[model samples]
Target: MRFSREDLARVRLSAAPDPLWEVALSITKLYRPNVTEPYAEWAAWTRNVDDLRVRSAARVLGSLIPSRGYFPDFLTPADGSPSLEEGIDAVLRTPRRKLRANLGRLGRLPGWAQGLADGDPAALGSLGTAMRTYHDGMLKPHWERIRRRLEADRATTGAAMLTGGAEQVLSGLGPAVRWRDPVLEVDYPVDREVHLAGRGLLLVPSLFCHGTPVSLADDDLPPVLVYPIAPGRDWMRASAPERQLEALLGRTRSAVLRAITYGGTTSQIARRLRVSPASVSEHVGVLRGSGLLASRRQGRGVVHSLTGLGSSLVAGDDAPWPAVNSAQPEWCRPTPPPS
Candidate 1:
């Protein structure tokens, strides 16, 4: 993708994961489970879910999103609302002309889908209901892990930005993307180029988008690049806190570490773990002192986040400590926790 000076300045990473994007991308993964090795456990569990409503909903979505090839762009709006309900509302409110144009790309449509293409109110309502049901069944159970992984990716991106700015953030977006000054080349299934003509780009990290990064087929729409994220080693397991980590760090500290996987202020983590802010502060100090955490001021509060060491430890990796950089950027250097 080619970017102008204004585009570069306007590039922004999503603060949170896009629910509709995940919902749409996840449907693709479900059909091609063999290609998604990282999601094997999730695939197996999803297949065995005995909910009839979920199965019915999946069938409805499956017809729209093929295992490969074009799915309608209306499913994932560029300005995806923060909540799933709002996102679904956005999908349902797609202009009739836009819906026809997007769904028309699919060529021949099924009898039921014809209603959807025609902007029938009942069909639109059904689509909204199915999306809500499918999300609750498949994605909701794994949403926390998804959110945490995205947060970790954002933290890494934040560090990259601190070190080198937007260019660094683009370059560090994994091997699938190459940052070559004005143009960012991506490994896409099709030969295409997006000219961000001062409109900028929204870089969204997704849990379900595997292999190559995805962009909307229509260049006229808002520019969004949804790329795959690396699911940590412990992503597919049950929701129990790691006993081994707890044993090593003791219960409160371990809980504190896990809570900060999504990064939070003192009161935020304290509220999450149901502990007093003072106790959380004490533990945060120890963790930061040991190089397992990093704290930086954000407005009135200090936001605590896991360092690479803390992340590796939390993920249960036995990797050696990362080498310390002698010339770390000022922002990359750790800040003292807020007084």
Candidate 2:
């Protein structure tokens, strides 16, 4: 596939991240094993694990997302800062006529998705619930690391474009893309060309997209190119809080602490640990009281992250730490254990 740029001024770069897109693309790993190496450990760790809720969700969403071919563009919007609930609302609001047209174009959809065309409220609600369930189970645990990689990619891409030009940044996107003067070529199963006639383009970096960059099937929607970002070996290290913490706090609480290394809310922590939100809240309260965790209110929920004391304790305990303020010592940054 090729993207035609009438002029250098016609090209644009964006680094907005969305959770729904991650859910849509990451589900592909469940069915496509060949490209799962980078995520193989995570995939294996999550497979057959308890959490029947996420499993049911996977089946429902799996049908919506085939191994190939076009799915609904509305499912993965390019909103700058997207949340699961917001994405669900968008999906529910999709016009019946547009939903049927998109689904019919894909030949046959899953029963749940088909029910959506018939305006089944249950199916719509179920799909939304399933998506949240899946996100909580599969993606929330690794979100901190994922977010860091995406931020790094944005910084690098932005710097490249500033130091050089759009041509340099486009050529450096990944091995799957090429810049040939006025057109940007990408390796796609389907042959097509998108003319960015002053509309420019939205460059989205994804952790789940393996090789080919994905674009919307509809030309009318804002053009977006979702490409993959490689995670370093350090980022691939498994999450294991210090054995001492486990002994001190018990296994479940210890694992919860490790999952919140980069900080998360009660629902996110609960989803990651596969425990009840109330349980997580209780433990978080205990940890906060102990000065091992700090809570900040964001929107309707509180975001829990490690305080400096908490960071020092986790570092001493030998758990993975997220990035901290630059003023802090080197011990605060996440580093792989010495071999």
Candidate 3:
């Protein structure tokens, strides 16, 4: 809660985005919606869309290593954004002494983590396997969109800091965080003050970080502040459609079209709908061929958005399509929904 002058002076901004943290936080999101209300909607979405494996892992981990209580920092080390594989490897390599100490701080090591106290290889392997499976089921599907959103936040934060100052940017972070003079007050689950010492601070933007900025369990560890970024426009507009578009495109494609407006990759869309990527890709390919959707490469995946024709179609503009003389033209061209 209070930062010394040295800590304030050493404050630094870095976007070391880590998938490991996302994995833990997302599991937390599904596990504890009552505490983190911002994630209530997301929890519903995850329940509807996340695979069974992810849900199962979340339940198990949530019961054991609570999202609110102290957990091992090595589970999610804050050293520059490590890949999921690398982070898991690090967890597997956690020193027995360090693991024991961290778990002791939390009272007892959960059954799953007890192996680490004895340096059991099976325990480490099992943990790694579960984490990897959870990542593939939950985070990987939406990582492209997540990465883009975090990158946008990074740019925005950098701009704010440049134009105003560190204090200004910190003050503007979110409602849950406050920039009091000589102290950064965060609405944590419990009372805690982190004296940053001279270690400075690492600011990590998180999508699943709902209500408050989260700091690591151990104050001795490198100081990092994980805060939430406002959801993108696509996140809020999943289910709006004109009746005419629904009839013309059928229910599934129409839904896909609406989802494309949010601009995400194939995996992201598939995950959103709880369907297979292959199925989504088939539809996306068809839509792309029909000039209803456009896509551009982003990293290893493609981000799809509505084209002019597609946008018009969804917006109830039959003007884009000339009238067909046939009695039945795409489900009678039903009356378009009110704009």
Using TM-score, give the best candidate's number.
1
Candidate 1 residue pairs that clash = none
lDDT of 2 by residue, 1-339 (tens): 344454465455553456777888887765553434676656655563457687777777777776566767767764432455666788777777777876777665655577888768887788789889988888887775576567568778878888987788889888989888877889888888787666777778888877788888877777788888887535545445455767888877766776667667898777545578999999888888988889999999899998887777655422444432323222212222121
- lDDT tens digits, residue span 1-339, model 1: 999989988888876668888888888877663644676666666766668898878878877887667789999998755568778989999999999999888777766788898899999999999999999899887675676677778778777777788898898788999999899999987799788999999889888888788889999999999888888545766433365887789978988998798788988777555478999999999999999999999998899989999987877533322232323222211222121
**lDDT top scorer:** 1
lDDT of each: 0.79, 0.70, 0.68
> Which model is ahead, 1 or 2, in terms of TM-score?
1
Among all windows of 10 consecutive residues in model 2, the one with the lowest summed lDDT is 330-339
TM-score of each: 0.75, 0.69, 0.64
Greater-TM-score candidate between 1 and 3 = 1
Clashes of 3: 0
Q: What TM-score, to 2 decimals, does candidate 3 have?
A: 0.64
Q: What is the lDDT of candidate 2?
A: 0.70
Error of 2 at 223 (Å): 0.3
> TM-score of predicted model 2?
0.69
Where does the lowest 10-residue lDDT sum fall in candidate 3? 330-339
